[model samples]
Target: MNPSPDLSIIIPTFRREAMLLDAVHSALAVPGLQVEVWVLDDSPEGSARSVIEGLGDPRVTYLLHQPPTGGHPAVLRNRGAQLARAPLLYFLDDDDRALPEALARACAQLSASAAGVLISAPQPFGDDAQRVEEERAYFEQAVAWLAQGPSALRVVARLLFGPALLVCSTCVIRRDAFLATGGFSTTMPVYEDIDFYMRAVRQAGYVAMAEPVVARRVGGPSLISACTRPQMLAAYAESQGQYRRQRGWWEFMALKLWQRLGR
Candidate 1:
């Protein structure tokens, strides 16, 4: 029998049929890697089922989440994490395509380390994608900070106070740690990733692959836009609570002072 998959990619999609298929195809195109792609479709009527069945590819598994996820990717992603069969996990957006060679390199880097996260840059497409390039550059710069003298401190500081450093499609998360840390939040839809990252970055070292690993088709879709008022409030509240617990205010002040005083 074929060896168990070397990696598991979990994609949470809505009613985006063509894009989801493209994402799955891109995932399966990796050379010399046994990979499984799990598509968690939260679309009403389960439209994605037909798409996966038509491909008839055993490597792809389709799950129709009941009552729909209401555009909450965290809920779908958490479910995918539990059912995954690989030690290393990659989260790919339904609208993005994975770069095979870059993904292969990232997998190798993460495998060499015992407990760490892997981050790679994103190759954006379309007009809205330009902003993604700017964020990708910032993330790459922070990734470099991890190689500095006070590695963990620098990374933790940056992550706590800086702009987002995650593009799920281009990163690798260790499966065990993901589960142990409770994965993403189902209750807090918006910024659930930020909450998850705050905890994960503290627990693991990070492996950085400077090259781009995902071709993200950007049209600015997010859980934030679809969130209800209560959900948005909960998101804001939870993030503020987390910030307080982390002494974020104090740290932010210290970082600014260090920048000017050359500390």
Candidate 2:
């Protein structure tokens, strides 16, 4: 059989067809490389299926799960990873767009650091369409920190309780490492990415932050980040509890403070 494409961009989309289309266009525009795009539709009515099919791109694969399994981003993500034709997987939001060299650069980074199981980058974008200067500066710092091996203490201190840990869409992970980590934690109502990242870092021996690979388009109407707060917090607390049980109570308490402080 012929080889699979080099990368699989998995997008878990609800109902944002227009933004999803824009996202697909950006993925298709990622310069040079054969890649597959999977759209995991969780919408009730199969709304985005036609739009995805109309793209007519053989590289695109759309999967719809109706009356969908709720709180299964991890399950959907694992399904995407399983269907992917490549050893490397990139998780993209339905509303995000890749920058010009995002995929190519991520592939290069993975190749260079065969030791790294997960490679993440900055998602540079603004409330407006244009890139903001502050975002650019922050990205530079993140890249530098990742290059230096952000450290176990740092990973625990910063990642265990920081805004930095929750952004899963910016991450590109190795297929083996993802599977080994048991994929995403489906049981957690929130902080699944945090749980996954901690496990991935522990298993992979290394997680590198490459230069910004994606230009994530934020400030949209249907952002997952814009989810209602009480629900989000409740989910966050549940995930935090899980992390505590898995790790330790003291570590969990420290992490909880970080969350409560809005860190």
Candidate 3:
């Protein structure tokens, strides 16, 4: 009934009610923008309903998938995007917190540039000092490479072999552009963000912002943390095969060589 907001912040959550509340609060706190927060709960028992309703925020919409779709953040994210009413869509993890100026800065950058997607370098927070250090190094490398005006091959190469810059929570994309790109892959249980980012960067192009717009909490038993190393490697291998099929074998080989030579 109400008019659409300037931006839609879609947060896919499962069994983390408290963290989802914090994430919603952070979204609401974003300055200088009219934002609608969509909480897509995939919990089996609709556990997040009470928490979302208790917030009593008009701008927040609570969505629960009946008969529970199991633990698939990528699927929920795509569903959220489909239901989004705003021109801009931001995918935020339920455990992460957006900086006060995150949306405002993203809006400014989108308005100033022709790039379809804008990604921020997130600052790692919480208990894991080791993870924080690793993320910092990764962020530094990613920013440096992004500064060089990377091509589609470079984007894919960095995502696969170098420091990955494809954190879904730090991304802000145009609603139309996102829909056109076919959204995230439903088949990928891991590296789905990377898969989506490679396609998005190639189709619409991207801009990387130096400053962090979100605080990524570490040391938690998240989806990434729960996955075994073998599972991760298998997923990466599968993704690489998909990339070759989609982007052509020759381009993939050329890109791999280009990355190797540059390094």
Candidate 4:
């Protein structure tokens, strides 16, 4: 088996077959980059098999869960990381399309920087698209006016209280950093990305890119859509404060202090 590629793009899917094909096609089409795309199908029917096989691109590998993941996207995501060969991991959803240039840029940034995670600005689409763009822009611009301290630290703090940076589809993370910090949360069904990515940022800081890398399809058949606003908020509230209670919290702080005092 081919062991290591420039980037490992993991897409976890349930019912979105056609969109999954689009997502995989866009990923495989990334120019001047070698990517291993892992499509994990959590659908019991294994409906994605034929489409993935028909693509016949060695770069794309499909796996059907022997028993479905019971609606936990995090389980499929974490399993992909365990099996992926690349040193860098980019998690993309079945419905989102990747912008080649921005993705390549993200991989390059993560390769050069020591940061654990790198996230690109997202281009939101679908219903309330304009509203989504406005809200995200407000946070990105506000990072400078509302927060103080180091760049990554400010981002960490800003997002911890509320979301400024989102869409894990646009984020690239070093393999070591991902393993060290722990991947997405298995227990929490909704807002699992929030729990996981926030922990990822807090551990080793993050690289925030301005250009949009992912054409995110919001207000669609996604986790947020499946849950009510109150349910989402409740899940966030229950898990937000607890994700940080991990083994590396103090070690991360020590490293931060050493960096601060070094100069």
**Candidate with the greatest TM-score versus the true structure:** 3
lDDT of each: 0.76, 0.70, 0.82, 0.76
Q: Which pairs, if any, clash in model 4? A: none
**lDDT of each residue in 1-263, candidate 1, tens digit only:** 12598889999988889988999999999877899999999988898899888998889989999978777888889999999989989899888899998898889888998756776677777576567677556666655654454454455555445555665676788888787667886777677776676566666766667778898766466565466898766775776566566656776566545544533
List RMSD in Å for every model shown: 3.7, 4.0, 1.7, 4.7
Best by lDDT: 3
C-alpha TM-scores of all predictions: 0.83, 0.79, 0.94, 0.85
Whole-model lDDT, model 4: 0.76
- How high is the lDDT of residue 192 in model 3? 86
Worst 10 residues of 3 by lDDT: 157-166
Ranking by TM-score: 3, 4, 1, 2
Give the Cα error of residue 23 in candidate 1, in Å. Answer: 0.3
Better of 1 and 2 by TM-score: 1
* Candidate 3 lDDT by residue in tens digits, 65-87: 76565667889889999999988
Any idea what lDDT model 2 has? Answer: 0.70
Regions of candidate 2 where Cα sits further than 4 Å from its true position:
1-3, 70-72, 126-141, 163-166, 222-237, 247-263
**Model 4 spans with C-alpha error above 4 angstroms:** 1-3, 127-151, 247-263
lDDT of 4 by residue, 90-206 (tens): 888898899988889878877888888886666767678676777567546644443333455545544555444565676888888889887888877687776677678778777
Query: Where is model 2 poorest over a 10-residue stretch in terms of lDDT?
Result: 217-226
TM-score of 3: 0.94
